[model samples]
Target: MQSNHTEKMSSLGLSAWYGEKQALVNVSISMKANSVTAIIGPSGCGKSTYIRCLNRMHELVPKATVTGQVLLDKEDIYGPGVDPVMIRRRVGMVFQKPNPFPTMSIYDNVAAGLKLTGMRRGKSLDDIVKSSLEQAGLWDEVKYDLKKPGTSVSGGQQQRLCIARAIALQPEVILMDEPCSALDPVATAKIEGLMASLKEKYTVVVVTHNMQQASRVADFTAFLYLGKLIEYDETTKIFENPKEDLTERYITGKFG
Candidate 1:
């Protein structure tokens, strides 16, 4: 909103319920294309649930239901005849834990999604895999030994491998849930730096517990508390001069 950026995804009065219990309130946020938007909030505030709804991952849970609409490129993802598999391919996800297929090699780990999407194996797949690893900043480290187990690499490299796997799909958007929470500071920094470059072409939405991380890499940040969206604005404004008292208090470390 600050820079006249085009919106890539948006939610209109979105709410979620797991069986009888509600997890997210009516949440609406327009995410900028080719920009990083960080979702920050305390635990149990529905940070994870909100992003899960983006690609319809939330519905995978039993008795899950959603109200309102999630739009990707102005198309309602939850509308009738919409394919969840197609939406997943268009909007990828990287979990908090680096979940490279343990049984697969580095090459296969990146190739798994492609194969599932009916991408025939050939030079095109090979080229895309190579390009994706390069984009994720992990090719150089593992290029020589792509045959090695994906988890054989260090924690950070494994995380980058997962990022590469997501990138291989050439998704327009990538949702990361605390992607660096398991890594040390050095590894965390690498992931953070990667996100900065990633926003050049992919609309990224990350849910992070580290407030400093949200402040550092996000173009815009949304603060949710107890399932309610307290404030949404440019990162600088949210951190420096939030309009809401709740936002100010949270940013100041008074309460989170």
Candidate 2:
């Protein structure tokens, strides 16, 4: 879990505002390539906002503004001439809830993004969908029922399907926002397991309220409070001996 990997993405003095209210305040953190970095905090700590900024999703909201730089592979994603669409494709995201396209077939749901971008078609598209599902660890479970509506699957399967959709885009980074918050323990375990293998191919940044989940799946962990970063370090250290008093208290269940 403590391998020496190169930094894949980082935010430098990044701050965000939703209309008049600031959601993030000069927060900065780095994620290593092919590793999982977990962001843990109590509600309204800007966990979701932080990850959204990574892919420029925050700007999609009305009155949302961000200041500072988010570097992906040493280049600022918000720099001049950079397309937000391409940034999102390279840094895919999975939401807190499973949100498969309700109107599309399971296979179609995964192919939707590719088709929208006009990236692939025919047999090549088929192959990508299959490969993506396999990567998501969902191929064996739903391969035969590819034609079924996406929502036909169990919540867990649907979440994996959403992941497959993201993988289909061949992203370098995957940002998940409380991915297991709506799942049962057994289902949550499956997603947790997927995160371990996912980091082998893509940099993963997950926002979770569950400290235990962060400890179990993340190589590095960041603790945020009231939109400010409290501490960040190897997961083992964060859980066992955090450098910040607030981090220690939060992890020890004394306060958040």
Candidate 3:
């Protein structure tokens, strides 16, 4: 069962649609502050869509739209005059692929978000980029090569570079969609460790197919199936003793 801790983020009657096709039902689950919430299930289960909604990313799709309330500390993100760009500043996202700007240097990749948000050249920008890279566990490897093209880094380092780019803005929440899926085991391990450290400062919502990664990094786990939330509970309970059959079956290798 989920904890009784006051819901840090509340969702009420949330749903989404792509054109006329419904992608998610009336799903609602609250996440605690400064904790990692893992969304896991089979492919096409709407787990990625769900996390994208948290940061208003679903709206980026041409035919996609969402209904119902998603509250960040009880403030509706969909409310009037709320700039999606500004909201994204507060709620950052890392994609499944490491999509660093190919032509940009490592330093520039990390500085991209800050620059878009009106941060200018100076000591402050430098400090923020350096600190974010360090926080993402990429500084030691790339600090000497900051001027190199971002694409020149290995797949793993590039992924961490993307993470550093996300953190450079110092977002309050970080949404990751299968961040480690393309990485090797060692690289995936580094990102997992980064997620654990990140929760100490920011609320983290991750969508992953890897059940073990969820169990290791998440404080809470929400299982979704066929556009519906089947169960949400503490990580330990969900893996050790899930309340729902679907959750158990998926976790036990019955099927994705």
Candidate 4:
């Protein structure tokens, strides 16, 4: 069961399609403000597509289309007259791979986001970049090396750098799609640690295949299967005592 805390975002009858194939169906769940919500299930269960819809990124695909309501602060993001770019600004994303601008320097990579959003180069920009890097726990390691290429860092550092770029936007919500899928245990741990700290200011929704990671970081967990929501409850309840048989089976390694 979910508490009565404020919801930062919620979906109503949300569904998505790629050409003729339906990807999701009537999926509705509330993401609480300043909290971590983990979406877990087997591969191809619409985890990525569902989060993308939250930020209105699903429409970026060639044949993608979505229906229903994606409310941010109760405002319909996909409704008429709403701008998708603005929606992205309010909801930043970090993908599975640490894709920092391969050619840009670390400082430039973080600054790019601010500049694109019309924030100019100055003390303010510098402070935000530094603070975001610090917030992502990458400052000490790369502060002096700001001139180096973003890709010059280790896989873990690159991922954190990407996170810094996202946090630089100061988005209200952060959406991550299997952020640690490609990282080593140490790097994964660092990112996991970062997630816990981030919810202090932003709502976080992550899709992960690693059930243990979800159990460790998420306050609430939503289990999905075959494009349907099977169970959504506090993380402990989902793991320790899930109500749905499918959720229990998947969590216990009976099947993914």
Top of the candidates by lDDT: 2
RMSD of 3: 2.8
TM-score of each: 0.96, 0.97, 0.95, 0.96
lDDT of model number 1: 0.93
Off by over 4 Å in 4: 1-4, 120-123
- Clashing pairs in model 1, backbone N/Cα/C closer than 3 A: none
Name the weakest run of 10 consecutive residues (lDDT summed) in model 3.
Answer: 1-10
Off by over 4 Å in 1: 1-4, 120-123
lDDT of 4 by residue, 53-157 (tens): 999999999999999999999999999999999999999999999999987999999988988789554568889999999999999999889999999999999
Question: Model 1 clash tally?
Answer: 0
lDDT for model 3, on a 0 to 1 scale? 0.90
Stretches of candidate 2 off by over 4 Å are 1-3, 121-123
TM-score: model 3 vs. ground truth: 0.95
Write down the lDDT of every candidate, Cα atoms only: 0.93, 0.95, 0.90, 0.93
Per-residue lDDT of model 3, residues 67-175, tens digit only: 9988887899988888888889888899999999998999999999988778554668889889999999999998899999999999999999999999998888899
**RMSD to native, candidate 4:** 2.3
lDDT of 1 by residue, 141-222 (tens): 8899999999899999999999999999889999999999999999999999999999888999999989999999999999
Candidate with maximal TM-score: 2
